[model samples]
Target chain A: MHRKLIESFGIRVRQCREKRGWSQERLAEYSGLDRSYVGEIERGRVIASIVTVQKLAQALNIDLADLLTNCGPPSGPGRSN
Target chain B: MHRKLIESFGIRVRQCREKRGWSQERLAEYSGLDRSYVGEIERGRVIASIVTVQKLAQALNIDLADLLTNCGPPSGPGRSN
Candidate 1:
């Protein structure tokens, strides 16, 4: 469940970045995070802190709520939203 | 800016917990986190990881997006939304 949660968040980050036509490197640059770190996040290799989440939201020009949408454990018993 | 951001998140956590009339210890128990850790999060002394945030939101019975509302840096210029 934890793994799924992290992976979903990474997917969300990638989706938002791609929507903006920005590369991972571009996101790193805009968010003042390391390129490797951004890559790790997108790959779901790291558990990002709230501060990191805020930086990503700011760089992506999205609200924190929007950035976090659909990024947690499966909502319902049989399936997730 | 980072300090303010963490502080706001802490404030939000405190508000939610209080609204539910749950003590910090109860929040920790429900979230499966250490009591001290929950206290730290509520005091703005730590930058909680995504997992921690998820746990808290689940324990509070709130959506992640709703839990994060008003938890980041203020919006707009000179004034925050």
Candidate 2:
């Protein structure tokens, strides 16, 4: 996995959660994920499944696109989109 | 996992591939995935990780958001986001 991309994604997720005044625990509760797992995600320690990403988007009351809009570098050749 | 959502995502992936006139094998080649795995994803038989999704999007020359924009039902309450 691309470490930088994962870190960017984690930062975006954390920012979104904070914007809603939700803790990792609160976000986990709403997303049906474990609190520690959510923390891991925020720290870019885990590669989340698409379903997990969708769950987080829903819990944040945002579109999945919105959640990912600012994540990572711009699309480029020879890299994962 | 949510069956409907997975199915919808599969359909979207299939549509995108077809739009580019690429077969599953071609997509797999471009995305650095196994052909059978690509087929499984198109059939909604497995839940893809975010890294996998990014790879496919990159191979398809599209954004991850575009791939997921029309997937599944609208966001609803009490469901994994």
Native contact fraction, candidates in order: 0.94, 0.64
Superposed model 2: Cα runs more than 4 Å off: A71-81, B70-81
Relative to the true structure, how large is the alpha-carbon lDDT of every model? 0.78, 0.76
Per-residue alpha-carbon lDDT of candidate 2 for residues B4-77, written as tens digits (9 for 90 to 100)? 76777788888878766678888898889999999999999999877887787777777777777653332233
TM-score of chain B of each: 0.82, 0.81
- Place model 2 in a CAPRI quality band: acceptable
* The best candidate in terms of TM-score: 1
Measured with C-alpha atoms, the lDDT of residue A27 in candidate 2 is 86
Q: RMSD per prediction, one decimal?
A: 10.7, 11.2
The TM-score of candidate 1 is 0.83
Error of 1 at B12 (Å): 1.0
Residue A10 displacement (Å), model 2: 1.0
Give the top-scoring candidate (DockQ): 1
Q: What tens digits encode model 2's per-residue C-alpha lDDT throughout A26-75?
A: 88988899999999999999988778888887777666677777533322
Instruction: Give i-RMS (Å) per prediction.
Output: 1.0, 1.4
